[model samples]
Target: MKAESETKNQKADSTELDQSSFGLSALNFKLKIGFDGKRAANNLTGLGNYSRSLIEHLADQFPEHEYLVYAPKVKSARQIDAFFEKENIKLKLPKSGPFLWRALNILKDLTQDECQIFHGLSHEIPLAIQHTRIKSIVTIHDLIFLRFPQYYKLIDRKLYEWKSKSACKRADKIIAISEKTKEDIINLYGINPEKIEVIYQSCDDSFKTAFPKEKLSRIKATYKLPDKYLLNVGTIEERKNLKLVVQALKEVNEEYKLVVIGKQTAYFNSIEKEIEKLGLKNRVLFLKNIPFTDLPGIYQMANVFVYPSFYEGFGIPIIEALYSGVPVVAATGSCLEEAGGPNSLYVSPNDATGLAKAINQIIENPQLQKEMKEKGLEFVQKFNSSVVTQQLMNCYLSL
Candidate 1:
């Protein structure tokens, strides 16, 4: 009797889903999708960029589908106002409260919204929603905390590991940003490789466009940029290994300056100490709070873009440099090669001398620089928004 009753219930649930899908199809409507936009709404780092760009591209490619972004708080109207203006996109903020309350509110909203699919743009999903019928997907950017435990506090690493492991197990589908990330997920978590989808992310479209000469000149003057400089962008964190670039500066020609952009952390103090010790105080410039609109011009004006990070899921800065028609010199032993492509030069992460040589090679050889620029531009086409969006859409449709 128990088996017969369970079978009946399963059949009923299957019929219900079929009826619901058919009803939506009849109405010419697509699945209602929800995204965790905490990073998208507040942070401007790689996770935030990924969240924003994915949503923008998905909306542009598939306008018929509804997108609901759930966040703890909507901090800036300007940050998401443009997205809200679109008919198919809506921003859902939690009611005033603490973390648990806000999380419960978001879960309630997801259920009430009747979201057919809920995508955690980062490595998290509401535990409350696991019982719901909503299909869950999570994008696991990297396992950096697991790989480099020393770089993170014990408690933080434990928290991240728990969240990531739980999300990978709970998600109906896993989106890995790179092949390296996908492999890490499989090996670390023992997840079946078939369950994960690899999708590459493109930088902001702004990088692909060129600013007028007068505007570029104005930006250069406003920033007080040198005539020629090697550029490095990313937060001032040890994992980024920016000290290698500073060390490389000691070996490079005196006329070649090094410009570092991105937020400064405690690590900046150590890097500054090294710069002073090497007598490169004036030659190495550290910039903070650079306007987003000015980054493309800065990349275009660069003699070479150096990314010596010890590891990454995918290097957006390299792609940005590629889009901006700049030669790239990135480190090996991670996904940087995938980001920099075949034409860009790569050196060992800790090899300051090799980095210096690569930078000088590009700087002195105009032909090599032009070749890298051309090849990178061609290589970057595979990551275009239209291409990536379609791949993401296919993942959604499969579910």
Candidate 2:
């Protein structure tokens, strides 16, 4: 602990420790790696962002290594434009049968490309990946469907189970995004705990940027944001528990409104109905379809960030909030505590009163807010991009 502490003080960042500290300074390992790049190419969801961030940062940190992105189809979009142009990262697609291409291309493309390691950025790797000589890894984001069965339809649950189990069975190593996910894999799927590594995820680099006051003001005007508000980011699904915050809003300080930013689901109908019944319709603001570029400013403009999700594999929004210098208030049931650290407050997902108390505590006290913000920013360095990328590289190097 002393050595680590001394190292942290010596370097500009903890992750910038001497490469020899990781036993990698002398090793000249330049690997050719492949990925199930669909998440990076075709998704704007959690899985998509995870793939894009990992790939892009890996390429940036280890420039000598070639990172091949294998996608069945590539979406034409602005956010994903970086992958197409990044050095050491190449996008590969099949000639035909786009749906079958990912499953069918593994043996051919990986072997032909001389890939030494193939990573499934989400849960499933190629079914035929085991047949080849390349070592394989799969990142299991969460077992939410298995953990909370009621939320998913039976057929969807079964399909997710099959894919996850197959990937765990076929992968040489399992990288769980959180310790809870690792435990779920072992408990639900009976995977060996020894084969699984807990690797946390980093939020986008944009969230860490400090926007100029003029830019922040422009964004505030564009969104028609309230003078001071609480922020929540995630999909508006039942498991996410956005309703908990809405319920708390009626009891918290009258001056602070709740700003909700996320994609909506049918569950939102119930949330809307509850807001209407509570007579706090004007107190809650919903920002749907906000561009990713505007997200950092939104987080920076917040008075506090609340994510009362019932469960998660790893809470990236918590990390984003910390990077934005906002204190976090999250649910206690899952990995939210890990993301928020000890200084940030945690309330039971079901306790609207406790949630309101925690919110008022942060909102009403300036010193507490400042302490949480400073300590939160310090705590989130563990999920720093360089740190996570190095951990991932070490995992690959272990093989």
Candidate 3:
């Protein structure tokens, strides 16, 4: 109890110091931006991908400015070391500190490093930094907990709402990954639409490059993948709506198998039960812990990539499928259309008949499949790193 009180007191002192420092005017010199690198260093999910891509592109395109990535600890250092090869980019890992002191320490380090602009890659910024002179930008991926409160516990929902609302209210700029998310912020928190910028995310470059047929065949043999299959990649959770895909497969009526790759949760038990109930044990395959290098080949080999997610800020897997030259069939009700483009087929999330019909349409028509793949490749060029990085640069320059 005493330790907790001391930590709170120290945080209060830091907040006071931050308020005093706010009077200093903005620096009139070269740009030095700092990023909250916790997600980039440890998380291999959507936020990590976004952080690494943004950092790599910015450093490569605009090497004149200094880029600093601050993290409390790095668990995936080897995975992200390539981004730090540039001379202008630096990774800042602070010494180990108490759990409660992390926020305060990050603020002190940012001030000491003299960062002109600080961008939070996820939906958080240190409270002390917001009161200081440094310009703040936060990337809000979604308001999922608020939108679907039943999926979250009461405590978590309150905490997420508080933190997100605070960041949106305090930060100088907000980067919403999709227009849907931006509208949610406006309607829920009443944040000005002018303050939010919608920036779409792109997939990794590995998906765009082609692999030799022999190499792809070798990977396929190693995984023992079927000759024809439908692929779906994402975390196995209830909101992702994977059961709908299973139900849709019952109507495929062909030799096509269903290949699912994702980390499983308790919700997966329900999906397994559904599969067993339908007697699809031999037709359904669940793959876990797939290497990052092999993912492109897996995607390239698929006949069609299906995403049955009910909601998302933006769908990265759909973009990845397009980059790998595979046609996509994703669900409606979110910003998936922005990622999959008009050529990709869409169906209602729970409409197994509609989804199955769309899938069979693409599978039976060779010309339609070819047209969708070609158009997807053409559409994905707009999300190339050069284009998206320039938009992010404009955000920093505006500040």
Candidate 4:
């Protein structure tokens, strides 16, 4: 009797998923999809860009499904409108404090929107909607709390860990950005393998090839960037391992500058002090905010792109560098290997000597650089938006 009852429950859960209501033409029973994001469209870093690109593809690929983008404020909504103007994608920005806004918006989405699935782009979701009818899915970007507990304060770490564990437990489905991230999730939260889907992200269309020499020259002059420099793109954070890049420059004989591009964080003082100590004031340049459209030109002007990070869930800049047709020197292990593939020259993360040796190898050998650049372009095609989005659609449709 118990075995027969268990089979019936399994049948009921399977029946709850309406297979006929999939794809764009199923407007009569369209799945109202709600995406939660905190940042504005233009303020996109790794998570923000993932949300932007994935959501845009979702809107285009499945036009029949109702897509509602829930953000914290009108500024983000306006930015979304400007960035992604798809007819099916609707932006909802509530006028309230962050906490209350998330609470009220989530409550409304669960009750009124009649959404079949609610995806929390980040870890945190609406705790208040615990008893609501909407099914929940969360993307665990990384296990930063477990991986690098030293970087975050005690309260932040504790809260993040708690929320992440809870989300993993409650989620109907989970999406892991990388395999390493998936492993972390399994180790930390003990989520079932079948419950979590591994979907690798892709570079945006903005990171592709540029126009003719004339247009490239205009963009190059506009930014006042060097014709050739070693590029490192990411925030000025300790975990990002910017110090290794600084130390590597001392070993290189090349005259090309090292350009560090990203916004300054609160803890950038140590990085600044290190640069001053190294007497690299002239050699190291900081371009804080480069326009989004002009990033490809900046990549075009680079001799090589290096990412010596100690840790990452998925390093998007490495993909951008590869897709931009630049030779890369990324760290050996972790998600860098997954992103850089077998074509990249790998070096130890914190070893300045190893980084310097890799940089020297690239600079001294012109043919190696050309060959690596070709391989990078070839490797990057596997992670194109169209391809990754189809994987995402497959996962969503399976749900």
Candidate 5:
């Protein structure tokens, strides 16, 4: 706690350093941006991961320009400073309004901050904000609300649909995480293709290295993972289509287990029932809320990583598994193919028999695994954080 406090104080002092000369440098044209980081703890999903990764990389790479992180009620000044405590980073106080407190607060702060550009990492943007001068960028991760509307609750579907459409319409620039998603925005949302850019997300650097055998062993012991288990990483939600994966697993009973790592959602009862019906309660394990630091070890322990989600913005875990040197088997449709490229074995998303066969084929063949790993590594280079950061910086410049 004391260490965290000291770090917070250091950040407070650093931000006090001169930001008056911000617009002078070419890097300053990179822009001072705001994002909804307030969704860190409670409602965390893919958006939270996207927000955290983008903010950390932006602050580290662009120290000359200013970054104003907007959050609700500053709870732990330590957590805020740890993420955005650099010389150019500043934290604005939360504002109150009719929408959720954090949303309302961020909406209010845009009027006050001397930012050149603003980014809504999530789908929603402050439609009421008097954006008379500053340019805005909103990242529409995917148009899942339109594509998979039945998966979401009615209220959530309506809210996300309204906000997503409004944000795309209002922003000066839009970022789609994949080309598939970019097409979805242009087709489903009727946004112009020229206005949007496709920037893929990268796996963490830690995943690229071979985790120490001892570390892998420790994680394996903790989770009781099989000697050669298949891995799936994501929130256990309805849209993730884990029931299909479970069905696939039942047909291919081997020495391996299907180990799932993610938080279980409220609507996952049907999946649970499916697992019970398949008699896979012992074979399929759901390990929820594992820390990011621990994920590389888990990935390293797996023989093959599988992500059979029906849809995605960009499947970070697919490449993450690839980088960890685990062979990947993903569904043919959606962004998994984009992430996995030619290397990954892709089966139809809803085909339990095909998915089962793919998993078994990878298990039986060692050479296939080696080929997939090498091809995955080659494809992963394009989406490196450094490369993606430059692309993002260029987008900011364009804005």
Candidate 6:
């Protein structure tokens, strides 16, 4: 009923928003491809990771083609700098200020570079892209701003809707990160279902690597992580439902602490007040500056991973946890089920007590933890790099 109302509201206001090539030997053409790599250079959150990982995997799997990463100028190179330095992948930068150039003038550069296909890694393509001969594809991550308007500023919401609608109308095909997002796009923008493709996003390959016991201990010591902690990773905001997990912590074992790592937002002040009110000041810990390389080791050390977000295009932290061999407990609504698979536990985002029970159910049973770890690893194989990258290549080739 809530989703229905949200869909109706989005309609009244009206707006918008695979895989690999089969055989390398079969597809004989080598073409130039461009990506909206601005986030690849500057942002450090989900979108940044998505842009960087997708480009790297595609380059590795389909080495025959040229990969062009079009990013605005950055002050300094980031950790993913080495990944982009591959032989076939070249970084293209803007000559002027990033904003207008990225939105408008980048099309001129795209034509000059002779890009056969230009992909918007985030939620937009160049506004005038359809005028050119190059094919375009845009990946729509989610419609949270429209679905839950209370969390976004008025001007920001209007801008996002306008940009997403324009990009959807202009692009040759649309890629949705999850089926949930696909549904939102169709419901809100009235786009045809045939034009959209759902390609699941995977975690960084680092998460799948098993760190040595010595290194796990070192990372644990360096981060000052508690011996027993419940992990949650995502931006601190109203939509992520971090307070629900904090409330759930009040009922779990006293030895267990809740560890959170994400970019902070103004919503954190309410969380601090909630913690103080519940007398859990020492029970919650926040790590702000965690290095990207060390994050998987941190995940491997947790007793359990919890992601009680109210909504998501896809809850990526769940996949990271599953790959890290940790048990997962996530909220029931949204696309978390798609990420956690069949064995991991789930509770409603509104049910703090239910969430506590689910966490304790796994923590108190060692055999269950082993089973979940084994089953989760087996399940997440569907999102392996080979399978996902192949699907992505197919999408580009189709266009």
Number of the top-ranking candidate, with lDDT as the measure = 2
lDDT minimum window of 10 residues, candidate 2: 7-16
lDDT (C-alpha, whole model) for all candidates = 0.85, 0.88, 0.86, 0.77, 0.76, 0.87
TM-score for each of the candidates? 0.90, 0.94, 0.90, 0.87, 0.86, 0.90
Candidate 4 segments whose C-alpha is farther than 4 A from its true place: 1-29, 40-46, 76-78, 93-105, 128-133
**What RMSD does each model have against the real structure?**
9.5, 2.8, 11.1, 8.2, 7.6, 8.3
Clashing residue pairs, backbone N/CA/C < 3 A, model 1? none
Which segments of candidate 2 are over 4 A away from where they belong? Answer: 1-27, 95-99
Range of the 10 consecutive residues with the lowest summed lDDT in candidate 3: 19-28
Better of 3 and 6 by lDDT: 6
> How would you order the candidates by lDDT, starting with the best?
2, 6, 3, 1, 4, 5
TM-score of candidate 3 on Cα atoms, chains taken together: 0.90
- Candidate 4, residues 296-344, lDDT tens digits: the string is 7788778889999888888889998987878888886578888888888
Q: For candidate 1, write residues 1-399 as lDDT tens digits.
A: 353355456545644465465453314757889999887777765677678879988888778888998877665656466656777778887654546743456777777888999999888887866788999999999999988898999999999999889889988999999999998999999999989999999899999888899989998899899998999999999999999999999988888999999888899999999999999999987788887888899998988999999999999999999999999999998899898889999999989999999988888898998899888888887777666776687778778
Note the residue pairs that clash in candidate 5.
95-105
Worst 10 residues of 5 by lDDT: 15-24
Q: Write the per-residue lDDT of candidate 2 for residues 1-399, one digit (tens) a residue.
A: 453364356444434454555565524757899999987999976778888889989999888899999887789887788677988999888745576677765568778889999998888988878877999999999999988999999999999999999999989999999988998999999999999999999999999879999999999999999998999998999999998899999998899999999999999999999999999988899999998889999999999999989989889999999999999999998888888999999999999999999999999999999999888988888887877887898788777
Q: At residue 354, give the lDDT of candidate 2.
A: 97
TM-score of 2: 0.94
